[model samples]
Target: MKTYQVGGSVRDELLGVEPHDKDWVVVGSSPEEMIEAGFRPIGKDFPVFLHPDTKEEYALARTERKSGKGYHGFKFYYDPSVTLEDDLLRRDLTINAIAKDSQGKLIDPFNGQDDLLNKKLRNVSNAFCEDPLRAIRLGRFLSYKHISDFSITPQLKAIVKKILDSGELNYLSSDRVFAEIDKAMQNHFPEKFFNFVVENKLDKPWLKDINSLDGFSASNSDLRWVELSCLNHFTDFDQIPLPSKIKKLISIAKQLANIEIDNILIENIDSLRILRNEEDIMRILSLGLECMDQNLITKIVLLYKDIKFAELEKLDPNERKNEKINLLKDLVSKL
Candidate 1:
């Protein structure tokens, strides 16, 4: 059986970034042979195995046919006759279509290396239109890498527009869409991500009202905070308990909004606070305390107290419940 390095590993190597995970495409290998070789079968639709030692993925060279609609509606053919070149031809992007042999030799059957060197992202074949998810993935690649130099080719954009016009995106699950968005947010370029969605026309139907917001293009961090806050409104954060970092981030954002913080401080506070909230802080502390620290947390608390006091003053005597106003006055006096 011939084992060849393929997919992101080869692409990242060319771009000088150490690949986070290595995937291989194996030719002349069947499921039974892989099982005999101590690899575990993990794919249901296609024959994929996990290496016994390295624990990396090794997928057999295969071809596919569109059997139905949506992304998962495909029939995979895994005959030994299929070659590595045939498998690469089925990929979405030219950069991801390149592969490497067992001896670390580069393989460029589709000029994927040229696209990588030029920092361009082009589709491998017309089969790209068969799958609707490619558009989302393309937008994600743009966002994740923060690569503004490259634009999606007209042919690809036409295909994406066709998919969007078909209204099949409604058939796609929100969990899948949000999962990709969440993964893309892990990168440092969320603003670019939103811009990609808008440019591709995906934001109009799936993500309405979001495009109407002002200052959405301020920075990646600002865009991320706003997006996370909006998403939190839909989800039950109390049940899931967002991490301390995310919680601190949300709290810091709220503080910014309440106090109308300067643009300079907002831009330079710290990267760690972006895309985080108060629940993130509580998780890190792990114990109930009056306050966390005197740095930013203290400032946040004092600002929050001041806001609460102002609101208390706005309440008329008739609206006050018993001695609640008196109690608030006493608390403010102590502060």
Candidate 2:
């Protein structure tokens, strides 16, 4: 049996980036043979094994045929007769289809190396449109880099648009959608992912809220969720699985957005501090102050600072809290 380092391991090497994990595509191999050779089978759907020593995944060369609508609706075929070339043919992108042999020789059956050199993202075959998840994957890939010249190939772009138009993306599970977006957010240019969704009219069922928050700077991914929640009036915040910090920020931002300048009482400010802490209160107000006036942020910050050091410290703990609230009420009344 011959084994080849395949997929992202080879793709990242060509891009001059170090791959964190390596996956192997084994040709002329069977499940029983792999287990006999000390490989532990791990995959439930297909013949995949882990090396006894390295513990890296080594999947038998296989091909998949579309069985139904979504990403999981695939029938996989695996055998000793499946060629490495046949396995590579099923990959989504040409860049990902290329493989490297044990001898460190590059295998380029679909001109993947040429496309990689040209910094182009091209589909391997017409089967690229078979899986709706590829549209999401391609979008995430586009956001993976911060390159100024990064773009999708015209044909691939058309295919992705077609896939979205067919409504196949709606079949994708919410967890999978969130997983792809979470990975994209980790990229250096995550805004590209959101832009792709908007440009292609891709956000229908899940990302409707985010799509509405157009032109909002997403340079800080931590703030993106807050921006999404604050920009749109979410009736059910519990519907989306969000971290405690983000959920709190959203709730605070939403409340602060509608808060009247005249009704900013000392009790309300003190309650915010007691529940969410002072730093988070500032962040919530900061979101409201975004794109409006830099001076408002400055003034609010100065007020918070002045309230901290005012004569309220002389009072007892409970009275001090009340005094601080009164101080904020007095200052907020002016604004």
Candidate 3:
């Protein structure tokens, strides 16, 4: 069997960035043989295995043919005869299609290195138009540090526009749509993800509420979510099947966003100290009260830190809360 390092790790190495994760593509290997060699099967829709020792993913060289619609409608074919070139041809971008041999030699099947040098994002083959999610993924790579500066060729943009017009994006599941957005939120310039979608008018069905992210500057995903949803952009927030804790955070952020800063009560501030993350919750409240002076935000974080100073473990729950309420009164008076 011939195993080669492929996909994002290769692309990141070409760009001089150290990759955090690595995936392998095995050519001339079958599932039975892989099992005999101690590789654990993991893929549900494709032939992917995990190395016995390292536990890294190692997928057999496979080719996919479009049969219907959406991400799972493709029919994946894998066998010992599937060439490395066949697997690369089915990839989305040329940069991602390159592979590295076990002997430290690079394989450039579609001239991905040339496009890498030109700082261009181009499709590997015509199969790129087969999966509509690539359009959103393009926006994802556009938000990162290295690929963020790379130019999307007009040819690829036209393909994306074609995919958008084909209505295939509507077939994407809500979870998949949010998955892309969630990953983009971790990028260096995540606004580029939303900006690209807005510019391309690719916000139909799932991302319809994404209009603009003009003044957003936070790199924290929860902060990003609060900022975006508070402005009514991530309107699909309630339907995204996120964790219950995240839902509570969104609910709290919404409360903070619409609350009258002048009429803000001590109870509201006191309630914040009970949440899991006092710092982020207070930060969200501070963002909501943008008209307040910068001194107030700093003081608010500091004051909330001390609201639970006394050992209320011995008192009744109601008295403990009242104690917090009284302390909050003293704290807000200083503000």
Best by lDDT: 3
TM-scores, in order shown?
0.71, 0.79, 0.84
- Residues forming the 10-long window of minimal summed lDDT in candidate 2: 289-298
Question: lDDT by residue for model 3 over 1-335, one digit each (tens)?
Answer: 99999999999998999998999999998999999999999999998899999999999999999998877779999998999999999999999999999899998899999999999999997788899989998999988888888999999999999998888988888788788888888778888898899888887766655767665646677677766766663365544556665667776665454334477677666555444566555666656435334455456667667666658777899998788677778877877
How well is each residue in 196-226 modelled by candidate 2, as lDDT tens digits?
8777877667676354324444456556666
What C-alpha lDDT values do all the predictions have?
A: 0.65, 0.75, 0.80
**Lowest-scoring 10 consecutive residues by lDDT in candidate 3?**
288-297
Q: Which of the predicted structures, 1 or 3, would earn the higher lDDT when compared with the native?
A: 3
The lowest-lDDT stretch of 10 consecutive residues in candidate 1 is: 285-294
**In candidate 3, which residue pairs get closer than 3 Å at backbone N, Cα or C atoms, i.e. clash?**
none
- After superposition on all CA atoms, how large is the RMSD of candidate 3? 3.6
RMSD of each: 9.0, 4.4, 3.6
